[model samples]
Target: WLVKKTPDRYEVKIPARIFHEYVAFMRARINKGMGVAEDAIWSAATECLFLTSSARTKKDIEDNIEREVIGKTIGKFRNKYRSALRYGILDSAPDIDVLLLAKEIDAAVVANDFGIQKWAEELGVRFVPAKTFPLMLKEYLKQRSSISHSTKSDFFDDFEES
Candidate 1:
C-alpha cells in the first residue's frame, strides 16, 4: 500500500490483502496509462516484504463483531451511524496493516481508499494519492537518471582534461 525509497532500492510494504490483490493494483495503473507506476511497483516488489500483525487481526475481528451486532440492533439510528461512523473508517485488516506499517516505518501511504486516507490523516501519516503516484515516481527516476548521467559526464570530462 506504500513505498519507501532507501539509498539502494525502493521498499514496498504491503499487507496480505494487497499482496493478494497485486494484479488488480497493477491493472488499475495500466488502465490509467501509468505504466511507469506499474513498473515502479514491480521493481519494488522484488524488495518488498509482506507482513501481518496479530494485534491487527484481533482488532479487525473485534471491530467486525461489534459492527455486526450493532448493525442489527440500531434499526432507527442505523442510517445516522452508518453515514457518520462507517463512512470514512478503516474497515478491513489490510487497512489497519497499511496504517500500522506506515506509522512504524515513517513511510507515505499510497492509496485511493477514502477510509485509508482519513485514517492516515488521523494517525499523522503522510499520504500520496494513487492517481499521482506514477507521476511522482517518474519524476524521481528522471531526476536520479539525470544526476547520474551528469556525474558520469563530469568524471569523463575531468579524466580527458587530466
Candidate 2:
C-alpha cells in the first residue's frame, strides 16, 4: 500500500503566555536564515501555530521588544489571515487552552509549561517542548518543501539521514 504524501498544511496549538515568545523566536530564526522568505515564514507560522490567551497572560508580556515582535508577527497575521487566531470562551485558565485547542484541532501542542504538558499527555495529545519546537518546525518546513519539489525515489530516506 502506498503511504499518502505529506499534507501541505499543519497546525500547532499554544497558550497565550507562550505565544509571544514562540512568535518572536520563530521570526528571529527565519530572518537570520537564508533562502526562506519573510512572507513565507509568516505564512507558515500563522498556519501552523495555534494560540489562545487569557487576559492575564496577555498582560504579563513585559518587554516592549518582545511585545513588538509579537504584534508584528502574530498580531499582523491575525488581522491579515482572520481565521488563523481561534477564539472561544474559556471553561478554565488560559493555559489549558493549549491542550484544549490541540485536542480540538487534532494538532500538537508546543509549550514549556509543565502543567500544560502534564494535562496534554493525560489527554493523549502530542506535545513538544517550547525550546525545541522552532527547530522541529524549521525541519518540518524544509521536508515539506522538498517533498513538493523533489522527484528522487530515495528522498524520504535522504531526508531522514540529514
Candidate 3:
C-alpha cells in the first residue's frame, strides 16, 4: 500500500490465478465468521481481474473439477465470480497479459507467483503481493464509503495542492 502511482486513480493488473485466490479468500473470510460482505468480495472481482483468453478458458476447467467429478456446484460459485471479469482485458499471454496491462496503464500488478515476479522485475513493473491486497482493498473501500459527497471536490481537484 505504500506504493503510489503518478496518476492517483489507476487500475491494478490481476492475474487470473490471483483473481481465483481472491474469491476463495473472500469465501473463506465469510465462512470463517468474519463479517465480510458478498458485494465487497464481488466488487474486488470486478475491480482488477485480468486474464489471457486461454488462461480464462483454463481457469474454467480448473474450477469445474468439483462439479464434474463430485456432483457439486463449486463451478456455479466460480462462474459467478468469473462472470465479473467479462469486461476484463483479454490479451494473449505467456502469462504476460498482467505485465502488458501494468505497462500500458502504469499500474501495479497484484500477484505472488515467482514467474510473474521474475517477469515483472525484468520488465520494471511494480507489484504487490496477493496476500495483502484483500485487507488493503477492504480498508480503502471502507474509507471511500465514509466520504461525504457534499464535502467532496471534483475528481481533478483531488490533485490540486491544498
Q: Would you list the rank order by lDDT, best first?
A: 1, 2, 3
Q: How many clashes does each candidate structure show, in the order listed?
A: 0, 0, 0
Evaluated at residue 68, the lDDT of candidate 1 is 65
Q: Across residues 55-97, which tens digit of lDDT does each residue of candidate 2 receive? A: 2443343456344654477655545443332222122345556
Error of 2 at 70 (Å): 35
TM-score of each: 0.48, 0.36, 0.34
lDDT of 2: 0.59
Score candidate 3 by lDDT: 0.55
Whole-model lDDT per candidate: 0.66, 0.59, 0.55
Candidate 1 residues 26-77, lDDT tens each?
4354345434544454334322221232344333444554446443444434
Candidate 1 weakest lDDT stretch, 10 residues: 45-54
Candidate 1 local lDDT, residue 109: 100
Which window of 10 residues has the lowest lDDT sum in candidate 3?
Answer: 85-94
**Error at 161, model 2, angstroms:** 31
